[model samples]
Target: MIDDELRARLESLGGLDAGPGSLAGVVVIDVTRVVAGPYCSMILADLGATVIKVEHPDDPDYTRTFPPMLERDGADAFSGFFAQYNRNKLGVTLNLRHPEGKVALERLVAQADVLVENFRPGTMDRLGLGHERLREVNPRLVYAALSGYGQSGPYRGRPAYDNSAQATGGLWSMNGPAGGPPTRVGTIIGDLAASLYGVIGVLAAVRHAERTGEGQLVDVSQQDSVLTLTENAVVSYTTEGIVPEPLGNQHPFVRPYELFACQDGFVFFGGYTDKFWKISCEIFGAPGEFDDNPDLQTMGARFDDAVYAERVKPMVERWFSGRTKAELEALAGDLVPLSGVKDIAEVVADPQIAARDMVVDAEYAGYGSLRTFGSPVKLDRTPPRARGIAPDTGEHTAAIFRDLLGYTPEEIEELRAAGTI
Candidate 1:
């Protein structure tokens, strides 16, 4: 139970209400640990949802203990991995195995607008907090499940991560250079896609609940999300019996659609149409035989990677190796679709990124300010912002127990002593 002093402190907070965010008045319970589910909830929090994260002191979320922890008051305060996704939220420790803890979560479920989880198919069912039971508690609750395969598939119980989803969903077959062993994408595409899909599903369900007072399950599968991205390949196989393979940066249907090296930088530009291809030949000052030949001019001829690799690419390379980036910009960058490759440092230093607020500062009590990414969505009247840095493990347990759930001081104390906070 909270002491008298703590209760008084929480009561004093009542008069300091914050201005609402876009998702204002929404209550979200985040029973997620790692990337996909937490990322979905983080976006919700940025849009003004009051997110409450659940964990236990004895067995905290994996991110909290991962790495790069800040020392505060002689204990691990915040971690980079945890803070990256859990920003703008409350936190509470609940030993769900304990009777009191389960009761507390049930009470929370009854009041929540949404509940997100990333556990295996039967885990929540075993914990007695499955979607059906929670729907009984609050029919308007939007229950979201982020998982590998899904809740009712043959692979529903298989343990998976970003790599597993990428491999199984055919993303591995579409990345890297030709003839190379299949490799996962550089970024965690599987996890991020699932997160965005989860957000879309939840928002749709919430809208439905508002209209009909009927909630529904928003099921998101990482493997399924991966397939959504590789839809072109799926279509190709279905209609034409062609299995798409990695051709590095080359476009299969378009000629001259590849990266070309300049003296000072790397540029990616695709010249496909007759107009663009003629312009490309002129810019490179191709020889008469090559520039005037109709046989080599069509997209079909240049579209073959083997033919282009052997006959035409060498001439373009020699021409590009002699020109500076500024010279290329003057010649083709303006008229052609092109972008210079940027490393992380260059991307952060770009004027456009700063003006768009893609990076922002995050400050904490114990930790000094650090620069991290900001929300990507932009709203003219109600832009999203981080509510605060992430909460430490169970940081808001006391306040939430008394202020939100209406648990008495004595009961809170009893639960605390019983390891059921």
Candidate 2:
């Protein structure tokens, strides 16, 4: 039964609508935090699912206190970064380590359509809340697990972060400059990629359940997910017996496919096809150069010619140096693809981002209004809204217990005293 306190909390967020379903009836139990799992669940919530995020009462998500903490309107200021990833979901605190907490969780699972957890391999089983256990209670529950390594590998129990996954998954080796040490990507690429894959798996499972009334387990590994993004690098090494290293910003087998300096900053230029290369030469008034040397005449030949790179570098630099990034972009137009490398600030303030409503206003009761990234996906009939500020630890304890879980005032106090809610 839904507790009155929980119901009150939901009411504060505009009570859950129970009408004809359109993802509106789906309930997502979010037992994961940090980047990947939270990101995946947020996508589900954006699509109109009711997501209840369960965090530990005492050791609430560490992200809540991440840098740039603000003190606002009587409540502790939440980290902006934390708020960004956690929007569009309801927050509740539960000490899953306790028996009472476990019982409460079972209650939640009974009504949930999907449950996402990112605990290490075997952790859920240890808690008796693994996929098999949950399926026993709710046969139609889609239990999705996200981990660093897979559930049954030799490395299954090993802990991993984004950098570790990048290293182990072969992404770092092919990322940086040719002579530089293997470098992890600037962002949590592995985590984000894994989250996306998890979402795909969950959605697929959800559809299958809707059709056949059968739910299944979704096991996603960050290592495995990131390997997919490595593309041909893995295959090249396996098929050709060549261990690939970083090629800097250049494509391993493509000539003129790298970033070049202009008079101002930098511009990435790639003319992959022979026809495009011919056009590039013509644009730079170097058509004769494309025709003269047999090695420079074809794509494959140009790719293998180290000396040819030196010969062409100066010309490429000179042509780019004469124009501003905007001018160069205009000159290339649809004929050639060119982009000005932008930093985060520039990306945030970009006209395209603004026009697409990629940044939105989120109202925190204490903070007034805060800006965060809007949903990246668009739905014709169900657009997502930034619902509310991330809840303070245990802020909704009384509300969730009294409203949604149907607990009485006495029971709430008893649980609080017992340190179980």
Candidate 3:
């Protein structure tokens, strides 16, 4: 049971008057490191949850060592990678390997609405702080376990990283050029997708706990999440004995819906739809020939390898070869939906991205205002945002100990001396 002092603190902290935004009163005990789990808790923090990020005293989150380090006070400090994901959370250190440290975490859990971790299966159970044990501390606490594989299954015990998850989850098989070696998706989709799913699960569990006062486990597997994004690959094979192979920049079902080289760079066109295809034909000044050709009349027919290579590809390439990305974009509209394939820099400077507030500047102590991604989930009233800078490792340890756990300064010092925190 939560102690009287902690209960009072929780009440005060949970009140809407305590802060602004959607999740003002909720508290999260984030025992996650690196990408998947940290990203999930970061979303909660952005939504105004008081996320206390707990790390071990001896070994902190590995991302803290990631590059693009910033110097603070003339000393090498701050990792840009860690800052990008860990912002807007309180940092606390506790050596969970120690008995006192485990007890300290239990106290924090007693007052938290959520606890998220990405350790391997049974890691928490071995520490004697598994879901069942934590439920005893706080019946309404949502436990979100984000891992490479789910808690149950043959592969549950296997260790995995983003690349491994992607490789095993079937994403690698469908990427890259046809008849070429399988390629990984450019980014860490495995970890990021799992993080997104973890966020959904956490929110749902939190809502359920709010309604029935019964908390549940949110098990998000990177492999499973990646598999869901395979986009009909599974059914395509199962339903019709056709295994999907890599198609490079080409969409499997849409002709002229692939990347095309232009004067300067590339542009992606989606003129496979009949309306758009006709408009494209007219714009390219080949309306009569394309519209009249029986072989290229329909999308399925245009998608045929022979038709595309023999008739469509030559004409499309000729049309795009002389035009710049800007020129192609100028000709694009509702008639022929198209976009320039932009690099990261171009994407960062895009007008649409700016208008949508997809990028915002986050001010760190040493780094004045580094640009970072803004929340895509916009609310008219309680908008989610990166509310504040990330806490230094254990920066809020004393404060959290004093306010939430009612620990005296002397007690905190003793724990510190004992290497428990």
> Please, what are the lDDT tens digits per residue for candidate 3 over residues 33-126?
9999999998988887778899998899989999877766766588878988987788899999899998999999998999999999999999
User: How many pairs of residues collide in each model?
Assistant: 2, 21, 1
Best candidate according to lDDT: 3
Clashing pairs in 3: 14-25
Q: In terms of lDDT, which candidate is stronger, 2 or 3? A: 3
Segments in model 3 whose C-alpha atoms lie over 4 Å from true places: 1-19, 287-290
How high is the CA lDDT of each candidate model? 0.81, 0.78, 0.85
Residue 376 in candidate 1, Cα distance off native in Å: 1.3
Number of the top TM-score candidate: 3
How many angstroms is residue 353 displaced in model 3 relative to the true structure, after the best TM-score fit?
1.0
- Model 1, 1-421: lDDT tens digits are 1234433343234221134456767778999988989999999878867778999769988877767766668655678778889887788899888878888998988878899999988888998889999999999999999999998779999999999899999989888887777667899899999999999999999899989999999999999999989857888899999988887777656767788898888877676766777777777765664456777777788778787888667756776888776687678877776566778998898777999888787877667875678888998777786535787788888878887789998988988999997
Total colliding residue pairs, candidate 2:
21
The lowest-lDDT stretch of 10 consecutive residues in candidate 2 is 13-22
The local distance difference test score of model 1 is: 0.81
Ranked by TM-score, top first: 3, 2, 1
- Kindly list the per-residue Cα lDDT of model 2 for residues 1-421, writing each as its tens digit: 2344433346355333332223666778999978879888877766667778899888877888887665676666779878777766777788888999888889889878899999898998998889999999889899999999978789999988887788888998888888988778889998998899999999999999999889999999999988998978877888998788887888777767788887678888886578877777777655586666556657676666565477655657777887777787777746976777777897899888998889787776656778878877876566665444565566666765665567899988887788887
